[model samples]
Target: MSELTLAIDQSTQGTKILLVRQDGTIAYKITKNHQQIINPQGWISHDLTEIAANLKFLIRKALSHAGDAAIKAVTISNQRETAAAWSRRTSAPLALAIVWQDNRTTKVTEQPNIKKREKIIKYKTGLPLSPYFTASKFNWLQTYEPAVQTALSTGDLCLGTIDSWLLYLLSEGTYKTEPSNACRTQLMNIETCEWDPELCEIFGINPKNLPTIVDSDSNFGTTTLFGTLEKPIPITSILGDSQSALLAENCLHPGEIKVTFGTGSSIMMNTGQKLLRTKNGLNTSVAWKRKGKTTYALEGNVNYSGALISWLKDRLKLINDPAETDEMAQAASKNDTTFLIPAFSGMAAPYNKPELKAALVGMTPLTGRNEIVCAALDAIIYQINDIISLMCQVFTDSKLTLHVDGGMIANQYLMQRLADIVQCKVLISPIQELSGVGTSLNGMNNQTLTLSVSKTYKPCLDKIQSQNQVKIWANNIKQLTK
Candidate 1:
């Protein structure tokens, strides 16, 4: 009997469930998208109940296709930094979960005291005092929502990330989170791998309200997910989606990097054991912890990437489907000098400009749908290139291996363009669902992943041409910011 494991990936956009066999092959997979829940206040949210229902549905659907495979355990990879406020007694959410991308707390971080203590906060948590983190959103809810305040006062509030919410619902009562997700809350100390008392007080979050931190691969609890399976499986692993992909790519060595393009993009480099204190906007986070041993990573986040392509299709009506952008981009004139700065939700990492709006520059008479489509694709590449530049600054080692994964990597043209602009060899992972695969692998003891490069994109442009193009883009952005 071949052993199997179920891996659930609850992301910003949707939930995916995969049944992996012992032979390192996915026996079955199911995906379901949830509502985005945007409001007039420009806050982004997810229906936690809807997400949980979808999780149960995906698990039931995958298990039906999986036959009688002997399942070993279950693991989860979820969107990091999205905070959830729930009732401890009834397990009901107090309000819509505050998404990581929501900037409602921007004014909160600008307070004199917060601005004054930025250096101290960053030094302790390895994260800046920004609205992008979970603590800020958590604080926002506690401050604005009357129900959240009441729950917090009554000690019935369970403030946590998506992973903890799912674990609590699935296991019927286990309130816990792992380091990879906990580190993004801005309340956990990266060095101690525990909730910091002073930082909790800074955010006005009580330590009792936070979930107990655990190792990445530690048992989250046992769950049947509302009897979707024959037997309860140990919830063996939980990790933030990006960090899970880092492990899935097996980027263990210092200077090894993996870029995951999804709703947003995260460019992370393994800095080994030593925490590289970066003066740049890049963030240092606990990559993972196992058996009390921890590893660290330097990460840069871009608020827009593949989401830009979605906007072009859904909002602008430029393309009927996302995949069409690839061919349109290939058809675009190479000489056209159009550049798009996708600051839809403000810029993050390296730039740190939250007030800047997006811009499309250098259009000409020949600019059309194809050129615009190409510009969107180029925007994704350039945003990723910016983060890669920052990661390279810290890891100055001559040889750097770049591993690429995500749904967007299917575009060979875009991958080639990314390689050319970044001037690095880009290796595409054959697996599209690396986050789920990584979470499943985390649960396995002494299991070695055999990852092979499906395709390699090498730099096609000369260094001078690449430099000039980047300079042009930067100049255009500077004009817009002014």
Candidate 2:
């Protein structure tokens, strides 16, 4: 029987299982989307029970399709900063998991107590005081949720990000998280790579409630797929989705960067071992930890990218399918002046305004569905450009390339526009599930895994035109902020 690595990617939109070959290529895959529970208060959540069940279903489904292939190992890549609380004794969720994009904690972060220590918090965590992270969500739970309060009083509360939640459920109660996920919690000290007591206290979180920090490639434990597998498989690796994409893109050296365009987006630049904190809005985080050594990174987040496309289809019903966006954008009038500021979940990174609402600006009588669809796609590119511009400033002397992988990369129009706006070559990965491939590569111990780019998009727009478009985007942002 041939050997395969079973990789599970539990993301915001869904849970996916991939049967990966030794060569870091996917052999078989299946995806199961979970419910995105949005309450009346605009708080977004996920039912942990539904996600956990979906994962088991995908595992069984993937394994049944494996035929004679023996599953040698398992790995996981999960959405970062989405916090969950559960009972350590009973293992039932205390409440719905708080999604990273949920901005309900804006009030918590703005409190006099938290605002006074914002600088100190930033110094320790290398993240700004915002509702985009896990700490404030945990604080919200502690302050308001009765179930969480009861669990904590009984010393049975287990707080963690999605990776740890999945790890704990899958691996015989292995409650641990890797650096990439841990560092985003705003509880872990980026330099020390451990949960900070001061930071935890400030967020009203107990260090004892957090997961044990482990290496990205640590032996997470063994799992039997909750009895679906004939025998247990070693769970070998765990990484945040963006960090996994970074590894999959082969961005191992300093100054190398990768952008993951998912529901939201994460633009990460590997900064080697140095924890280079930025004053210009980029957050510092642990890229990954392996062999007892830590690699640091600088990151900028966008709260809406692919989600904007989803909004077009689901909310406004502008497009029937996300795939139709490419043609719709191409059909748009070249002279159309419509622009979309996708601040639905509030602006992230560089701006850090959770209260900001989305706006569709400069629409004229000539604007129609095609123009609006085109503008929605352009919004993704513009948000990315905002981050890449800041990164260029940080690494003025270094020549940087933008290596990108995600669902949105498949849009030819989007990729080309991204290159035109960022004014750099964008290399698109051949692999669609880079996160799953990355963790699977680690599980197989394939340090020399090579990735070949399927396509490359280079700047084609005239310099003056590109500059004029960016200036217009800047003016819209300024007007919105003012």
Candidate 3:
């Protein structure tokens, strides 16, 4: 019998468990939904209990499909930088699981305490001094959380990102987190690969309470309490979703870049051994670590991409299915030059303008639903193009091909438009959920997953046109801020 690898790709919305053979090919897949909590003024949180239940369900189903064989390993690629403060005594979250998109830390993000250490954090961590990361969320609780605040005064607070929370529960509170997951917390030192006590003290986070930083391929623990899988499954690898996808892309060498067009899009390029030491909003993320070495990357983010498509369906009443983006774009008048800035919870990455609201510009009296809807779709792809260009500029001017994946790539219009706007070669892989595919690759024995050319969207626009459009895009960004 072939050995199977059970891979879990958990996001804020739900948990997706897949059954993959030892050769890195997916055999079967199952996705289970998760619950989100919206507080008084729209603070988003995940019920870990609800998430755990969903996880157990998917894990069992995936295992059942895999049958009665000892699996290779159970790997996880989690939504990066989302935090939860839970109790060790009781396997319960003390507060809400502050989503990466949640802006509850808006006031505290500008606090003098966090401000004082912003530069130092950015310099060391390669991340912006923004509230989207775990540091600001942890700090926000110190001020905003009455119960958790007092609990911290004692010794009852165990704060960790989504990966850590899930690992703790899965391991039955035995295994900790890996270095790649830990580094995203902002509390960990990239150089030392450990939680910096000084940084922790500054942010009111205790380094001791944090998870241990292990190798990328290290065995974190075994699943005891999770699901109905009778066998004790070993939990081996853990990775931030984007980093895992980067690994999956096999962009091991420096100057290689890939863009994940998920809910909040990210464009990450491998920076290799030396840190780029960026002062801009570009993040210095720990790509992955193995054998006493680390792979570093510089990332530029577009926090609203595929999510905006969902908004078009549910909120704006544009299309019942997101597949209409292709049809709608084909249906739209090409002359319609409308634009949308989907800063629903503000922008991230190169422009972490959390306070900035969404915008729809250059609308004419003749602008109908088709043009308007098409514009929103184009604008989202345009924003991604803007960020990818910024990433190339910030990281390196190398001849880079963007490896594209996620649900949005199904929209050919956006992919073609992305190729045009960015003026680069965009390669879409046959596999869509590449983040989990990457994590499972670690467990594979042979058979490298080659980059199959599904379609190569080349630069269709001339340099002059692209530059002029980018100039106007920047102007719109500035004016909207003012």
Candidate 3: worst 10 consecutive residues by lDDT?
442-451
**Could you tell me the C-alpha RMSD of candidate 3 in Å?**
1.9
Tell me the spans in candidate 1 whose CA falls farther than 4 Å from its real position. Answer: none
Q: How does each model score on TM-score?
A: 0.97, 0.98, 0.95
TM-score leader: 2
- Superposed by TM-score, candidate 2 places the C-alpha of residue 240 at a distance from the truth, in angstroms, of 0.1
* Residue-pair clashes per candidate: 0, 0, 1
lDDT of 2: 0.90
Each prediction's whole-model lDDT (CA): 0.86, 0.90, 0.78
TM value for model 3: 0.95
Q: List the residue pairs that clash in candidate 1.
A: none
What lDDT is reached at residue 440 by model 1?
Answer: 87
For candidate 1, the TM-score is 0.97
Q: Count clashing pairs, candidate 3.
A: 1
Model number with the top lDDT? 2
lDDT score, candidate 2, position 422: 85
